[model samples]
Target: MRGPAEAEAEDFVAAHTAIARPALVPEIPLHLATEITPIWQATEAWLGEQGIEPPFWAFAWPGSQALARWVLDDPSRVAGRRVLDFAAGGGLAAIACARAGAAVVEAAEIDPLAHAATRLNARLNGVAVAEAPGDVVGAPCRWDTVLAGDVCYEAPMTNHILPWLRGLAAAGARVILADPGRAYVPRGGLAEVARFRVPVTRELEDRDERVVVLSRLLG
Candidate 1:
């Protein structure tokens, strides 16, 4: 166990954008929450399941749950807009956007399990989520809105990802983040639109979290 171990994105994860089931279907036989957990290719985001291993960065984070609540609370934020959910785990944010009335919605992840689970969760909820691959960092794409939850937990990801998020905003996409105060959240203008207390497993650390919804400030 030394140097960085890695797998080709295709071998471990799907390279193409995928579509998943909705979240409210109540029985996700295809997508088990445990199966979506991330391997310890990175850090300590793992869920401590008995048979399940650690390094669970791929599973859905608490902030994603917070965003889902926000959507359920107020669907107008995404009403009739095209939305992109970055770092989509279990496709929560993207599903929320669809539930909120977005005409087109996508959930993206680089991890294979996470990406696949995103699609499954979409089916679970009876919502549609188009899954996309590749790192969205510094990517030049256009969308009406971008929704991110719990993506800023790691320093490297935040450093690379936040700038791209800003770029999306610069392209006029309304970027929103549901952050529960991880160490790596980048600083920028954020107008609070909503907040929530979400339940999180002890394995991920931090219980009774506060989910903050920020409105991206225009420059």
Candidate 2:
């Protein structure tokens, strides 16, 4: 059974966001913040009490958008495979994988609110996406394909997770990484797979669009 806090968190997410489709991947609907400032302020205030991460869940980032587009364009990439959406914010890619007929789809995140948003979005899409709560960086390779989007933004975080991601690749998992020109993305060790031009909110990206590069992480 879900606790009161969990229910409250879900309520907060539903109350603060609107159901919208990502610009690039419009087939899947997500709970997205209509405006940036209000959600940021609300998240900051909520963070003071809950000590949770920022509201990355309130937007469909470029990397995730690209991943979703790629998977939807080619369902065979995920169909019949067990897939993982790592660091899934609003679970766009996970939903795409599920829609593409993956045998199983799991969305992993450390933020409780992100989990809530993912659950809401998955339900809205009428897809079954299992939740892998908390940090799953060091977990064994339980999936055939792992999708990581926009995760290399911070230096420390990139450093911490990259090795584990590579290990998963070495262990025979097809680890896919989508990057939107983030500063910390590794220059090497990534074979280009596909690219996408994703529309973005100027309030968040300071631009009209971002070109996301999808790559296969080399072990």
Candidate 3:
């Protein structure tokens, strides 16, 4: 049985977003916001909570798009491996990993709305993505691969999560961070693996496209 809050969250997600495919990875269907401003404003009003972050899970960002594309193109990278999609907004990369045959796929998020959105998106794609609610930072690494996409946007968040991510790399997990030239991306300890030109809307970004870089986070 679902609690009232959980059911309301899912209802909000289904009501505010439409089922659509991201530009870079079109094979996987997701619940995405059609109009940016309306959804953003609506989320704030609906939540009725002050200082809530924008609904990042409503859209598939460039970093996740690139990560999903990369993994789907080469399933062998995650097939039969335990995978973690860190900060998994809408679980795009996580769904890709499941589709690519990962033995287990976990999607981690701190936002309860994001958790609901991920659940809806995963079901829409006909795949299983275990939810790792709340912060998974500083937790012991149990995954073979950790996919982090678009996670370096804010300095405080970057500072808080980067060291733990590095520790996971040191623990022998293949930590892949997909960055779309965010302001706070570290200048060192990243080995480039793949690059993608992802389409975006000017309403959300300064330009119509973002060049996403998939890199191995060096321990």
Give RMSD (Å) of candidate 1 vs. truth.
Answer: 7.9
What C-alpha lDDT, on a 0 to 100 scale, does residue 93 get in candidate 1? 72
Candidate 1 Cα misplacement greater than 4 A, ranges: 1-58, 208-219
- Over the stretch 1-219, how does candidate 1's per-residue lDDT look in tens digits? 111222232223332223322232212222333332334422222222345333233445667666766666778878888888887766777777887788889877775556655655565578887766686666676578888887777787777777777778778988878788777776656666766666555555656445455446343
> Please, what are the lDDT tens digits per residue for candidate 3 over residues 1-219?
668998899999999999999999999999999777888889889978766788999999999999999999999999999999999999999999999999999999999999899989988989999988578999999999999999999999999999999999999999999999999999999999999999998878999999999999999
Error of 2 at 172 (Å): 0.3
How many clashing pairs per prediction, in order? 16, 0, 0
Across residues 61-180, which tens digit of lDDT does each residue of candidate 2 receive? 999999999999999999999999999998999999999999999999988889889988998999999998679999999999999999999999999999999999999999999999
Cα error, candidate 1, residue 154 (Å): 1.9
Q: What is the lDDT of residue 22 in candidate 1?
A: 23
Model 3 alpha-carbon drift over 4 Å, by segment = none
Cα error, candidate 1, residue 139 (Å): 2.4
- What lDDT score belongs to each candidate, Candidate 1 first? 0.62, 0.93, 0.94
Off by over 4 Å in 2: 50-52
The weakest ten consecutive residues by lDDT in model 3 span 46-55
Candidate order by decreasing TM-score: 3, 2, 1
Query: 142, model 1: CA deviation in Å?
Result: 1.7
Q: Which ten residues in a row have the lowest lDDT in candidate 2?
A: 45-54
